[model samples]
Structures are given as structure tokens and as C-alpha cells.
Target: MNEVKLIDMLSYLEPELLEDDYIEKDMNKLKNLISKISESSSLITFNKGLRSIIKIITFIIASLLVLVGIIVIIIKKKKPKITKKAFNFVTN
Candidate 1:
């Protein structure tokens, strides 16, 4: 005759592994939290990308302004030289 142990028989019972209502509720809450976190992470990534683009545009505009200022100074310096040449020519 073969004899089965109680522990082995209990392990084969399907009803023993059934989840309670609280466990199901907690699982749903966890799923919702995970989804919210994923959504927020995507938003943060988009904001970071937008900030970098804005910074690049600002830097380009500042560089162009500086270049324009340098050109203006060079032109101003040349104007006096031209005026002096004209004055000397008129006096001669």
C-alpha cells in the first residue's frame, strides 16, 4: 500500500493559491502607480529636450549679435580715415 503525505496533497490543491480581495486591490493600485510614473517620466524627457533646444537657439542669437557689434566697430573706425583723407584733399 502507498501512503501520501498531507503536505504533498495540500500543495496540489488549486483553491489554496486563490488571491484575496485585498491582494487584488493592492495589485490594481500598484499598476496605476506604475503607469503614472511612466507618463511623468516621458513628460520630463520632453521638457529636457525642449530646454536644450531653447538654449541652443539663445546661444546662436547671442553669437550673431556679437558678430554684428564687431562689424559696426570696424566700419566706424574706417569712417574717420575716409573723412581725414577728404579734408586733406580739399585743403591741398
Candidate 2:
């Protein structure tokens, strides 16, 4: 084929080679997509961190509540079975 026809055929197959506008648009679209992906990943990291912190706080609160309940139960009860043994031991 002639050089002119070969060039035309190649250009028709690859339109971006013939137009600056298409190249610019393609670059802009790629940049925007990259930025969106970066932002979404950052958001995911933040959400995971927040969820981890919340889980740790919830576990701590549950443990403290259980400890408090056990203490209260032990302190609030009165038993009468130990007085005689205590008096005999003290007298001996």
C-alpha cells in the first residue's frame, strides 16, 4: 500500500493517535478513577480502625460490669455459721 493509505488506516484503527482531545480525556478519566480508589481505601481503613476501637471498649466495659456484680454479691451477703468456731478458736 501507499504511505498515505497505510497512515490513514493506522490512524483510523487508533483514533487517540489522531486527536489530542481523546488523549487528554483518557488521562483525565484515569486520574479521576485513581483518586476515587484512593479515597475509598482510606475510608475503609478509617472504618476498620473505628470498629476495632469500639470492640476493645465494649470488652473492657463488659469485664468491669461483671467484676462489679461479683463484688456486690459477695459484699451484700451475711452468713451466721462461722460465729461458734470463731469464738472457740479465739478462746483456745
The candidate maximizing TM-score is 2
**lDDT by residue (tens digit), candidate 1, 34-61:** 9999999999999999999999999999
Alpha-carbon shift of residue 83 in model 2 (angstroms) = 11
Candidate 1 ranges beyond 4 A from true positions: 1-24, 85-92
Error of 1 at 65 (Å): 0.7
Question: lDDT by residue for model 2 over 1-92, one digit each (tens)?
Answer: 89999978776676555666877899999999999999999999999999999999999999999999998777555333356668888999
Give me the runs in candidate 2 sitting further than 4 Å from their true place: 1-19, 78-92
Q: Which 10 residues in a row give candidate 2 its minimum summed lDDT?
A: 75-84
TM-scores for the candidates? 0.62, 0.62
User: How many clashes in candidate 2?
Assistant: 0
Model 1, backbone clash pairs (residues 3+ apart or across chains), number? 0
lDDT of 1 at 54: 100
Evaluated at residue 58, the lDDT of candidate 2 is: 100
